[model samples]
Target: MKIIVTPSQPYSDQKPGTSGLRKKVKIFQQEHYLENFVQSLFDTLVVPNDAVLVVGGDGRYHNRQAIQTIISMAAANGFTRVLIGQGGILSTPAASHVIRKYKTFGGMVLSASHNQGGIHGDFGIKYNIGNGGPAPEKITDEVFAKSKVIAEYKISDLPLVDIDTIGETQFAGAVSDQTFTVQVIDAVQDYADLMQSLFDFKAIRQLLASGFEMKFDAMHAVTGPYAKEIFVNRLGASTDSLMNCEPSEDFGGGHPDPNLTYAEELVKIMFAGENALDFGAASDGDGDRNMILGQNFFVTPSDSLAVLAANATLVPAYKNGIAGVARSMPTSGAVDRVAAKLNIPSFETPTGWKFFGNLMDAGQVTLCGEESFGTSSSHVREKDGLWAVLFWLNVIAVKQMSVEAILKAHWLEYGRNVYSRHDYEAIPTEAANSVIAHIKSQFSSLPGQVFGSYTVKLCDDFSYHDPIDGSVSNNQGIRVLFTDGSRIVFRLSGTGTEGATLRIYLEAYEPDSAKHHLDAQVALAEMIRIALQISQLVEKTGRVAPTVIT
Candidate 1:
């Protein structure tokens, strides 16, 4: 096949958000649109002639087509090797593991995580550095800047490789000293091996065989194959234990977000009185985030992180000890208590997984998470869904306790941080900006003021100075701290594709064991009322209630 240099112009709006550049499928289908960005990434990466690039997606619509284009473009760019998952499918966490395990230069993961996927739905691409984490802001900014002036992109006229086969295909004829190679790999094995090394699988299998009923919902997304292989084949769980274990491009027309709003099917089944199982779990579209449920209990992501940190030593990978821990700013303080008890450093950064990458790389943090249903350790560099699942199972098998009992005991030891996040999605950008501006304006006057039953202790816009790199990020979010240890935080969601999403996080710490049993909403009712009144959220947004509460 001959290499073709296709002329093209730059495309605006190519900048990546908190995660990646995500847009409707139509935008990506435009002539020379995807190529311009791909070329821009290639230009910014500046990989070697023999460098390896791993490419795969979440099995969404147009995933295969995009992979074919990338393979051709990689070959033309003088890359020697490319590794893609069979059928062009790789969950976000699995892709990260493959990149680290292979020591590739970097990787391209095509996934709009937790977003709907189809012809009209969202498609995305994220570049992960050789460390198996999302490329830091510096690299992403360079790619965006390059996309504006990119002129021509190189591509080969080779026919598309059959990605369904797990084998290597080599390009022929005159070229570089070494032939370009594309290898289709089994996606689940590497990730499974990593999980097995971290977990006590034999104990989990014994628990399953001794009548521990459980259910894992893949949501018909990329985790289907991973879960099917790990839970059923390796753990000896029955086939009926898995739901929607076949990857679907459109996620069966569902939202594919593992929240109460999107994963309602799992919620309903797990909440059923006598029909509930011993354990229930669900993974999002790209399989990084997770929602853990036990019988009728829904363990919030913040709680899940705290639980994992509190019991990290139970797992084999962390049996020695965790170096430290971290959490996104909006996450609850549950983990902080654990960190304090263990006498380890606990760093808090803005709301993105990339912020944790530096800490993990520097060995300052072994476990980290955000409030957005994400949790992971130093394992690979991204939030891992199945890893959290197996951690919980291992804890249960060792303690011989139910999820609720474990939570009660944990709260008894570390107190309770009741937390909730309210998302008002798709608000006009201007309106969202005005809301944030108002919060900033009130910061000076909020301190020493009383609203409802609480007196404000302080108010300010949050900022973080990365200890590893000494880079500073300011105004990450607005927060109001009360004298009673209650808090309210407001920020704009950076990952949404629609209009700006306003996120309001509320938390109240309770040390009294008797009051821990109250409903979270009820326990924080006064603080919620005061927060809404102060922000004038109803009048500003013209929406009485949040779009979604988690």
Candidate 2:
């Protein structure tokens, strides 16, 4: 193949965040801005000229344009084959699946996850290593470093080929003498097949058909196809049961996040009637995070994982029960109790899915979750929002109970780990840093300090040393553990590209079944208030309330 060299443009701010380089679409449209980042990603990879690669996005705005750019650059960089999803759309989980299925060196995923889409909204580009997990810190650091000084990016002036139909096309140049193949494969079949291998589809179908009402909201993003395939076609749910079952470039002019604040439409519909929907769920833009609700009742993500672990036998994939359970440091300790009872190891890690990859690879952990509306098993490296929704359906199917009944029964069995997460989003970066620093300063002498009614028993920054890889992450979050098992954690999220997000997680475990009836947010309100005061967040940020309380 003839070689082509395109000079890299002068582009700064190509640094990758927790997941990728996410920015407003307009920012990415700047001259050579996207190309520079793509070149940097290629520069960081070590693959042969004949290596195959996967490319796709969440069907967000600019997805096709970004894919075209990546394809040209990948070709210029001597990649032999590129397997792109049909129409340049692939859910985040689907991209991981394709990478692993093809055994590609790595893949480039364009998505901002649960954020809004459109010309004015956010866009992102992330490179996942061959293991189908997000690139490790070392690789991402190298990519970022190269991006800062990238001179230009190479691309072939290939014809504007249509991606809707799968076929092959030639670029018709010295560099394009080779064929740039596009395979318009079934986007949902492989992923659905993977889900089938992990869970019993017949059980889920029975649950949906046996007088159980479920509402699955796709939020007009990438999960629509997956949900339609699994829920309506395979699982026998009614056609109208799935909401927003069409993928829109602009996500239908709404934020695609599944949290209560963003997915208010679903919440309202579910709680509108006395005979409300039994099981209600929603997934984020790229379908990696999930929000689970039962009629008018919202099952907090922390509790959701614990309930799933306690009733793992309902799902055939976990029939043997989870080998081990893990949660982010900020999540409630509900699953910890389950792990203790089952005599399985439970771990606490930092707030990222990458942290769980090592444990999963080692077969030391089968299930893990974060407080940020995410849960997954070793079935895949990334969280599967739709999979979690199906898991809940299977649970209800085997138990033959309403959502409320199942949750009530769980509370009676495991008690309640009342949990709440307060997110102060887009605060001034300096102010957020100051709040964390203030919290850290109080750590050494805070162990025995008394505030109002509770006395702290232990205080320190949360850290993790992955048992499998021995990688350490210190200062994951700031924690104040009370003698009574009440705890508060403060951390700045690394996901956002703009201003900082201060996440305050509060948990109060009630082991007594008698007190399990209390509301979770109400029980943790006082603790959150105290945490805000101690962290000096209110005074520093000039905001007395969190942007979103989950």
TM-scores of the candidates are 0.98, 0.95
Residues 300-347, model 2: lDDT tens digits:
899889888888877888887778988888888989988999999999
Reference-based lDDT, each prediction: 0.91, 0.83
Instruction: Report the Cα RMSD per candidate.
Output: 1.2, 1.9
Residue ranges of candidate 2 with Cα displaced over 4 Å? 1-3, 170-180
Point to the candidate with the largest lDDT.
1
Clashing residue pairs, candidate 2? 7-152, 7-153, 8-151, 8-152, 8-153, 9-152
lDDT of 1: 0.91
> Which lDDT tens digits does candidate 1 get at residues 1-550?
5789999989888999888889889999999988999999988888786799999989998899999999999888878899999999999999999999999998999999998999989999999999999998888899999998889999988787999999999886236455888999997899998899999999999999999999999999999999988998899999999998788989999988899888998899899988999999999999999999997888999999999999999888999999999999999999999999999999989988899999999999999999999999988999999888999999999989999889989999999999998899989998888888877888888899988789999998899999999888888999999998889999998778888999999999999999988888898888889878888888887978988899
